[model samples]
Target: MKIIYSLFVWIIFGLMTAFLTVCGMPFVIIGKNPFFMLARLWSKISSKLFLVRYEVEGLEKIEPDKNYVFMGNHQSYVDIFSMISIIDKDFLFMAKRELFSIPFFGYAIKHMGLIPIDRGESRESLKSLFDAAKKIQEGYSVLLFPEGTRSEDGVMLPFKRGAFTLAVRTGQQIIPFVIDGSYKVMKKGAFIINPFRKVRIRFLDPVSPEGVKDREMLDIIRARMEDAQKELGSIGAGK
Candidate 1:
């Protein structure tokens, strides 16, 4: 039953995506915010199809038109859609470079303002991080996963310092987000999609770069994120 549902949802997403691609062409050509609107549409439909109930707290902590570094834990691919669903701000996502190899999805992601990092090479990763910082300085928000990869276990992983360094370099606020209940719905190595399950998105308070130096900022952000994750209770669904 779950397999069938997954197939159905994927089919719907594919078709809608095709249609959106065509509809988005005009907006893209005009240099309008096509991907932002497109992401919202896709997120709404995908959330409904997956039966993922989205909730957010602490949105008031975010300021308007201010640059920010939004960081969330990585779990499932669903986390990508879930972020798009909840975040109202127009932002760029820092994702793996391999995603660019995907056919239409890669093109859309690149055009949609996603920053790609080659994780295997430190120099390349630093360059991408700096580019992301430049984007933040240009008044655009950025979404990064400090864990660097999805969790094999449900527990939160130690954060990498790259995101913090980027925030310090760009002098932007850092917003820590906790995504609860996605690990069980779609585990790291699982192929099945279970829509009967529900998920929650918890946005914690923003961490400012004021008085924070580069050396200590990563630990501060990691501790804050860990505290927020704990507040969500059992983020890991029943295994």
Candidate 2:
């Protein structure tokens, strides 16, 4: 049953992505990538199809016109869509190169300015950071799962420095957020998607690197996310 449901969801995603590619062509021809705009649309459709109930807090703290490197704790594959559904901003995603292998989903993300990182190779990973820095200068925010990968137990993992580095280097602020209940929706190593899962997205206060170093900002932001998760009682599902 899970496999069938997964296939149906993937098929729908592929068709929608193909259509979005064509629909976004005008924006592409006009010197803008349509993937950014379509990401929100795709996220909305996916959440509804999967029976995900989305909730959010702290968005009112975000300032208008300010680009931020939004760091999220990955709890499940569901985190990506849930984050997009809550964030009301135009941003690009920095994801692994493997995700681009998906049929239409990969094709669309690659064109929408998704920065693919070869996580194992430092040299290639640094290049992705450089690309993200350039995008930051161009007035676009980047969404990154700084924990590097999803947490199997829903406990906040130690964060990597990529998002923090890019944010500091490009003079952008780091906005930390947490996703709860996604592990129950579908945890790592689980193939079944939990229907009508209630996933919560809580935006933390933005941390600035003005007088602080990148390493310090990383620690600060990680602690902030950890605190938020605990406050929200967002421990692993089934706990």
Candidate 3:
């Protein structure tokens, strides 16, 4: 029964996503918020599709008018949908360069100002960071996974400093978002849904770059994000 339900939901979710993407094409080309709105749509649809329940805490801490460099933990791909569903703003996503190669979606990302980074190319990463800085300067927020990649064991990995460096260099606020239980739902090596369950996402208070040097700021954000993940661990467990 669960398998039948999963297959049914997956088909419906795909159709809805395709429909939304086509409908939002105009807004995406016009540099509007439709692309971001599509994310919210996908998130809601996906939750129902996967039979997953999620709760977000501490959204009030995010400032409305200011741009933020949101550094988050890498758990599962679901984290992207979850965050977009919670935030009521149009923020750009900092993702791998390879994602830009996807046919129609890549073109849409380019139009909507998503910055792609080539992790192996320092020069390209630098260029991407500058582009991200420019976006923040223009009043757009950016999301970065500081851990760089998903943690295979559900343990926090050492964070890369690039996201923090961008925040410090651009002087944008660093918002740490801790995601828990995504791996248990959709992990690194698993594509088949096991048992549907609940997940928790906690948004910690944003940090300012005030008087802090760029070199050491990564550690600060990493500590806060890690601690938040640990706190979420106490609230629940996943099968």
Candidate 4:
């Protein structure tokens, strides 16, 4: 049953991606924000198809008009869908370079202004971060997974320095968010997608980069995210 369900979900996802890509590319080429519109629709539909219930908190902490550097822990691929479904801000993801090589999907994201980071090469990665900083300077918010990749275990990985550096360079507030239960929803390397799971996302208070060093800002954000993860874990446990 799980295998069949997973196949169904993937088939639907592929079809949706192809359809959206074809429809969205023209708008993107003509200078429209179709990525956000189509992406949010995709995320919402995908969440329902997977039966993943989201319990999102701390949206009130965000100022709708202000641009921010949104950082989150990496747990599962579902984390992207979950964030897109809930975060109402106009934000672009600083995605890995490989994603941009993915045929139709790649073309759409690239034309729509998603920043691609080459994780393997230090110089290339630094260049990508600077590019993202420039985008933030243009009043666009950005989402980054500071852990660099999804966690193999449920535990949060140590964050890399690039996100903090970009935040400091752009002088944008870092909104640290933590995801609890996505690991169980779809663990890394798992073939089956677990359905009817509850995922909690809590956005912590924004940390300022003004008057702070990149390393200092990284530590501050990591501590807050860790604490928030623990709190969410306890809450989930009590349920």
Candidate 5:
């Protein structure tokens, strides 16, 4: 029964993504936010279809009209939906370069003003990082899963430094977030679903980039995330 439901949900989700991508074509000329709205539509639909529940904390700490660089833990594919649903702000995503190879989905991401990084190619990745910084400077927040990959064992991995470097170079306040329960909902490498589970998103205090060294800032963010995970009794930490 779970397998049947998972297969059905997965097919429907892909169809929805393709449909929304077509609907978002007009927004491409209208610029960023409208396409972002379309992405949010896909997220909302997926959440409803999967019966995903979210518990959000620290929204009060998000300031009035201020943009943020949201760096989050990546546990499962479901993490993207959890954050997009919780963050009631216009934001762009920093995606892996490979996502751009997919036909319609790649087109949708480009229209949404997403920055794509090729991790294996340092020169190209750095260029993408700088482009993302420019997007933040243009008044759009960016979301990054700095582990650059999902955790296979529900554990947090050492973050890549690119996100921290961008924050310091651009002076965008960093919002460190921990997302729990996605591993259960849709664990890495499987279509199995643990439907109707609650996903928690806890936003830590924002760290200002002013007068802070990049490595120091990275350490602080990592410590904050680890502490939050410990508080929630969430498992996993690697590298």
Candidate 6:
């Protein structure tokens, strides 16, 4: 029964994505942003289909009018959908270059101002981060996974420095968010979606980059996330 339900969810998700992509093209053509609208719609639909419940905390700490560099730990693909469903802000994703190569979806994200990083190439990756900094200057927030990829074992990985560098260079405040229980819903390298899972998202106090070195900023965010993970009692917390 779970297998059948999972299959049904995927089918619906794919169809919805295709439909929304086509619908968003008009806005993209006219140079108006459609990501926030379509992304929220997609996320709301997914929550219903997947039976995933979200418990978000610390929204009061977020100022809607201010742009930030939002960094978080990655565990599953569900993390992306979950954020889009809850965070009420206009933010762009700094995704991998490969994701931007997908046919229709790629075209939509590219035109919607999403930054793609070629992680395999240092120069290109740096260039992409600089471009993301420009987007931040334009009053658009950016979401990045400092782990750079999802953890296969539900354990949080070490943080990367690229996001911290961007924050310091742009003097943007960093909002470190922790996502718990997403790995149990749909872990990396898994296709089956587990329903009725409770995922907790907590936003930590914003770390200011002013007068802080990039490495110092990185340590601050990581220490906060580590403490938050332990507090949430997430899987692999002590490991």
lDDT (0 to 1) per candidate: 0.79, 0.81, 0.77, 0.86, 0.85, 0.87
Q: At residue 81, give the lDDT of candidate 2.
A: 76
On lDDT, the stronger of 2 and 5 is: 5
| Prediction-by-prediction clash tally | 0, 0, 0, 0, 1, 0
Question: How would you encode candidate 2's per-residue C-alpha lDDT over 43-97 as one tens digit per residue?
Answer: 8987887888877889997887788888878889888877777788888888899
- Please tell me which predicted candidate would have the highest lDDT against the true structure: 6
Q: How close is candidate 3 to the true structure, as a TM-score?
A: 0.88
- Model 4 regions more than 4 Å off: 29-33, 234-239
RMSD of each: 2.6, 2.7, 3.2, 2.9, 1.6, 1.4
Q: Is candidate 1 or candidate 2 better by lDDT?
A: 2
Q: Is candidate 2 or candidate 4 better by lDDT?
A: 4
Q: Give the worst 10-residue stretch by lDDT in candidate 6.
A: 230-239
Candidate 5 vs candidate 6, TM-score winner: 6
Cα lDDT tens digits for candidate 6, 42-149 = 888988888998888999889988888999999999998888888898789998899888877787678768899998999999999989999999899999999999
lDDT of 1 by residue, 1-239 (tens): 88888788878878887777677778778877587788788888887877876667777777776767888777787888888877778889888999888766776788888899999999999999988977877778999898898886567777778888888877778888777778777889877787766676777777878778876987776666677677778543221
Best by TM-score: 6
Clashes of 5: 1
User: Model 6 compared with the native: what TM-score?
Assistant: 0.95
User: Which has the higher TM-score value, candidate number 3 or candidate number 6?
Assistant: 6
| TM-score-sorted candidate list, best first | 6, 4, 5, 1, 2, 3
Candidate 2, run of 10 with poorest lDDT? 230-239
Instruction: Tell me the lDDT of model 4 at 147.
Output: 90
How close to the true structure is residue 114 of candidate 5, measured as C-alpha lDDT? 84
Where model 5 places Cα greater than 4 Å from the true spot, the runs are 27-33
